[model samples]
Structures are given as C-alpha cells and as structure tokens.
Target: MGPTPSSSNDRSERRKRNAKTTIQSLEPDTLCMIFALLDFFDLVRCSAVCKYWNTIINKSKLLREFYAKQKQNSTEFSNKSTCSETSLKTYLEELAMEHHRVSLQEGLINIDQWKGHSVGFNQCRMKMGLILTGKGDKVMRLWSLESYKCVEEYAVPDTVPLVDFDFDESKIVGLVGTRICIWRRNGKRSIFPSNEGTFVKGLCMRYNDPEAVVGCEDGTARLFDMYSRKCSRIIRMRAGPVTCLCLSDDQLILSGSSLGSITVSGILSDQQVATLRSRITIGGIKTLCYNACSHLVFAGSTSGYTSCWDLRTMRSLWETRVSPNVVYSVQHLRSDKSTLVVGGIDGVLRTLDQNTGQVLASCVMEGNALSSSQNTYGATEKRKGRRLSEGTPIDSIPKSARPPITCLAVGMKKVVTAHNGRHIRLWKFNS
Candidate 1:
C-alpha cells in the first residue's frame, strides 16, 4: 500500500507550511534572547540560516546592547570603536602595527639585563612593580615598571635556582626547589616548608582573597593560607605532574596536568567537582587560564594545541590546533574574552578567537636561534627537558608561519612574550 504521488506531495507541502509559520510567528525580542544564550560562533551560524534570522541579528540596537554588556566585564571590547566598517578595519590595522613595532624590537640589547636567566613580572602595591630572574646570583630582583629600573634585590641563602614565581596586590611568592617563600610588600620575607616535592610548577592566588594555590611535580595541588602559612587543603591527581593552575572568581580551583587531564575542585570542601580529558595526547599540560566573564577555561598542551571548556557545563566548547610546537602560555585579552594570545615553541605569537577558534592575527619573533634546553644561563644543561619538533624560523618564513614561544603574560596595557633568545616583546592595541 504505497502512497500515491499526489498524497506525498500534499504531505510535504504541509510540513513546509508548518515550519514557515512557526518561524514567522517568533517575536524579534524572543529571537534576540535566544541568540544571547548562544556563543558567538553559534550566533553567527544562526544568522546564516534564513533572512528572518539575519534581520534580527543585524538590528543595530540589539547588537549594540549585546556588545555593551560584554564590555562591562571584558577587556576585549574596551578598545573597540563604534565607527563605520571601513573605519573600524583601518583602526584595527593601525593598532596592530603599533603593537608590533614597540613591543617586537629585534637584535637590540636590553638595558637592564641580569645574570642567570628566567624573568617574570609582578604587580606591586602603590603603582610599583617587581621583576624576578635567576642565575647563580640566587636573588630575587624587584623593579619599578614606571622608571624601568631595579628597586631592590633580595638574596637567597642557598644556591637552589628559582623554579616558579607569582604575586598579588599585597605579597610576592616564589618557589625554589621544594620550598615556598612569601614576601610582603613591606619587605618581610619568610619561607614555608612543604612535604618533599621536587618542584613547584604552578602558583595562583584566589580572587579577592589572601589565600593561594600551589601545584607541584608530585601530582598534588594544595591551597595555602598566605596569612597563616599553613596548608589548608590538598587535591590529589592520578599521574603526571600538575603543571598549571587557576582559581575562578567563585573560589573553584582548576588544575591541568601532564597526564592530559583537567580537574576542578572546590576550595572550601577540597572535593573534585568535575574532570575533563584531553582530546589529543601530548607531553603535558603547560598552561591554563580562566575567563570569569564567559565562564570559560583554557588549557594549553605541550603538543601545541589549546582547548577551551565551558565551566558551567563542564564540556568542551572548542579546541584548535595553534602551532606545531608546544604551547607554553595562554592568556585571555582583558579587553575581549573572545580574543586569546598563545605563545608556543614555534617562535611566533598568535591571537585567536575563543568562540570560533579562528586566528585574528600573528606576530613573528625575529632573532638569533637558541637551543631549547638552554635554561637560566642560556647554556645547555643535562637536566630532564620537554622536547618538541623544531620548526622554521619566523623571519625566514611567511606571516602564517609558526615558531616556538617560551612564555607570555598580560599586563594592564600590554601583552608580553618571552622568546628562546632571551627576548621579551610587548604587544598592545594602538587605539
């Protein structure tokens, strides 16, 4: 009993009519609300579905309101200008060039070069700043960012080299071997004893609190009360070292490990709330960052990829292959959460869109070649090291080329990238 051709045609027409009627009856305000719930990438795809969707999305008032709300908490939209399309394009280009020129100076000597090697920046109270570096000097050097000069250099007793450093508004924290040191802004320094651990790999402070979290190479992440200098809680991992950690505004501690797993735990209860496994296996997780505005968590791998996960849903939002080499650092642009800057073993710095995983722009590092194993003194050492496949140099390659990037940090006005050649380049928007 097969249906006749006429009956089949009639059924098909009715289905089409029903769909059209449903779409036509949807209110513009309701459509706007629906779009708001979706991510930027999903919204873009929705707009292409039909003419009705396009009309709602193109409404100036709706788009303006959405962008304004995003700007309130995100730094990404702070620098955007509401000008004509052509004018906006021109402005962005000029801003990119300005950021590239001032921050990416090549073949020049740094005025305040120090002995030893790894360098980091810390925000200080009263508009002051600190820079920590290592070598045989065995000292932490504090610097003034306004004057671009060293203010104080505190010496450490032992010859143990600094493994990691972090700071907040009130104090500076440094980890040398297994011991953790806390120094107040007023110049008091004290070392806190920890159970036997080879290295402290990650450090982060809780938002709006004096408490901090530290991750070690022994697969354990612990929360420490900075005031009391006591371990408050500990979250253990399965295997591999805990490489990077970040604390959300709600006091949720997120940790990424070399075992290709990301775990989230509540600080107060010290309970494992959620966990996500990597889509692709890598050497280890190198860096992690959180964007509170979007509730997005980003994890970068030693294998050269960055993965984004939604904190609320505990599901992967998107993952993109950033570079061929290992990704060392990842930071969300304060002005725009949609934009993220990634530094990797491939000496080039890339800015990507969070929703679509599209690269916005890339800047290449042009300098002398340096070996990967070269540590503090830029000299080869025999210690255990992470390895990545070597890629072509930035200057000799095209704009789309990828090169290795060692470290990255975002500041109030600029984003800085540290290259293998002991080069630190800053990037900022021009307008």
Candidate 2:
C-alpha cells in the first residue's frame, strides 16, 4: 500500500542509521589489544561471541604473545628500580620440567632375586656396594654387593643398639642407652656421656679426628672422643629434644631440634654461627642432606615438606610439598646434584631437581612381585596386556605392596631402599 508523503519521510528517516561494528571491522592490533586486556574468563567469553573471535582464540599463540609482552614490560620496569627481587626470575620457572627419559618411562631398575628380602629389618647405610646394617641392638652385619650375602658380622651384647646408627668406611657408631659405641671389623669401643639418663637422639662422626658429636634428648649436644673414650664437650641448645645432626666436614656441624630450629655450630668449640628456622616445623626435622658444590641445605620434616636453603646467605631458596606422609630420608644421588632422591613414609620415591625443587620423576616404592622372568616382560603394561597401543593401563595388574621407606642408598648403577621395619630391596640400573 502507498503511504502518505509525511509518513513515508518519517519511515525513511528511521530506516537511515549509523554503520554498526562487525567482526571484520576491527584491525589485528585492536583485536590483540582487546584480547590483552581481557582476563581468562573474558577471553573465553569473547570466544563465544562469534566464529571470527573463536578462530583467533583457538590459535593459542596469541595468549603466548600476550604473556611475552607482559614479561617484557616487567623487565623494562625492573631496570628502572633501585632494588630488585632476587627470587623473582626464578618464580617464572616454577613449573616443573618434564623429562621423558626412556629409563623412567620404561623400568629404572631390576631386583636382584638371589638377595631378595633375605635380611630382616634394620637401620642401614651403604658405601660403594657394601651395605652396613645394625641388626636388633647388639649385632651389625656388612652385606656383599653382588650376592647380597653377609660378608662380615659384629656383635657385642654389652653394647645396646639404638633404633638408629651412623657409619663410615671403617666403623659404625651407635647409641646404646646413654653411652655411644663404635664397632669395627675386629673390636669395639664405647664412650659414656656424663648423664646416663639422657637419651641419645642423633650422632655425627668427625672424619679427621677420632671424635663424634652426639645430640641428646635433653637438648644438649655432646662431643665424644673415640680415642680417649670420654666426653669432650657439651653444646647447649634452647630447642628441646635434639632430633638429627649433619656434619659438614670436621669443623662445622648442623643440628636439628624438635622445635624446627637448625643451629650451625663448630665441632671443636662452642662458637655458634647461625640458625635456620622453618617458622613452625610441624614435625621436627627427620632428615637433612647438604650439597657442598651448591652449598644448599635440604631438610625433610615430619610434616612432609622439603625445604632448601642457600648456605651463603642462610636464606631458604625454596620449599616444596614432597609427600603426604612423613619424609624419612633425602639424598643427593648425582655428582652434580641436579636432582635428589627422596624417600618418605608414604612409600614413594621421587627424583626432584635441586635448583627449583621440581619433581622430575616419581614412582611407587611399595610391594611388587617382579622377578627375573617378570622383568623380561618390562615394568608397566606397555607391552604386556595393552591392546597394541601405548598409554593404556592394564586392568589385570594389582596394586603395589607398601610400607614406609626409612633409608636410601644410591650407587653408580644401583639404588637400595630400606623399609622402616626389616625389609631391604636392591635395584640395578641398566644404563
């Protein structure tokens, strides 16, 4: 129908409007600026707007570019600052490195069947291939490397064995009641602290001298002279119930107490150097390992956290949640100490990078029935029961048998882990 001239003019005026913005209307730079300004949620929201925005969002390279620009901006801003944060650069690399080493993907080690679970549970240490163990409280045995057979044994009923002990190439020193005893291949020597009632909690041997330091349950650290068979000196600590001790050469000693305080003191004199605190150590420190090359101190606490400190400044470099259960031991296996071997009450073994405390590899150290015949089929189900493809789990395999790993000993081509009770497992490395 034909409209009146006045109505037609009004309709035509209403139809005439300004041009609206469209997906193709924006420039690349403008679109990137919008994306840069959007948070993750907003970016996702933009993806839902239309097919044009969805294509750009799916590129993913754009988000990476945005991050690069932000990092560049941070660098320029830091250059103008008077002071800088030392740990800021490290924070950028907090994401752990992913290592797809074939050994780890495959099986890392094979159990020596002949030596399988022969020795009962005991406190043990390994040097070279020889395993030094304290059996019960009165006997000690050195196991052979290849055969896992006991080559030498030492015992003294008069010397009561504590739950733990310390050893070296030649001798093993143990805490018996209030007295500390040193046993060798042939004879035995004992040193009695002044207070027989004070329980010995930790022991550290001085390599250069015939002396060792003992930390007592009463918060006192005593130096025992192995040659003189007497107490040398006692260093007092305000932190109660000394728990662990680590010797950094003959001159310097580090002691951990029940309160989560670590004190650095001299072995010869009572001169105290520094104390590194964990703020509140949920479970006093259970174990400590020091890397001389990096000058990094690693302490494992009962609370299942592993913390590393730089020795130069006495500042903690980093802390990481290592396990859900108590961490029993931490040891540096590599010569460069790029990674550490950690054993915990959770029955897990983790290989973590030293610099960032990033876990590079992990596996269960619990019960397994792998034998010489079974290992021929490999560890995982990659070749066993998979349907001609990798990355698939086998429904046939059962769970691992587990108990807490109390100690660990790593070699050039082997790793030995001890149970808290009386089981020891040996693993041989391929390459």
Using lDDT as the measure, the top candidate is 2
Question: Per-prediction RMSD in angstroms?
Answer: 22.7, 24.1
- Cα deviation in Å at residue 354, candidate 2? 1.3
| Tens-digit lDDT track of model 1 for 304-412 | 7888888999988777877776888888644345567788876666667777776666655333333334333344311111112245344556432233556666553
**Model 2 Cα lDDT, one tens digit per residue, 372-399:** 3322212221111111123223222232
Quantify how close model 2 is to the true structure by its C-alpha RMSD in Å. Answer: 24.1
The true-versus-predicted C-alpha distance at residue 195 of model 2, in Å, is: 9.6
The lDDT, on a scale of 0 to 1, for candidate 1 is: 0.59
TM-scores for all predictions: 0.60, 0.63
Backbone Cα, N, C clashes tallied per candidate:
15, 2
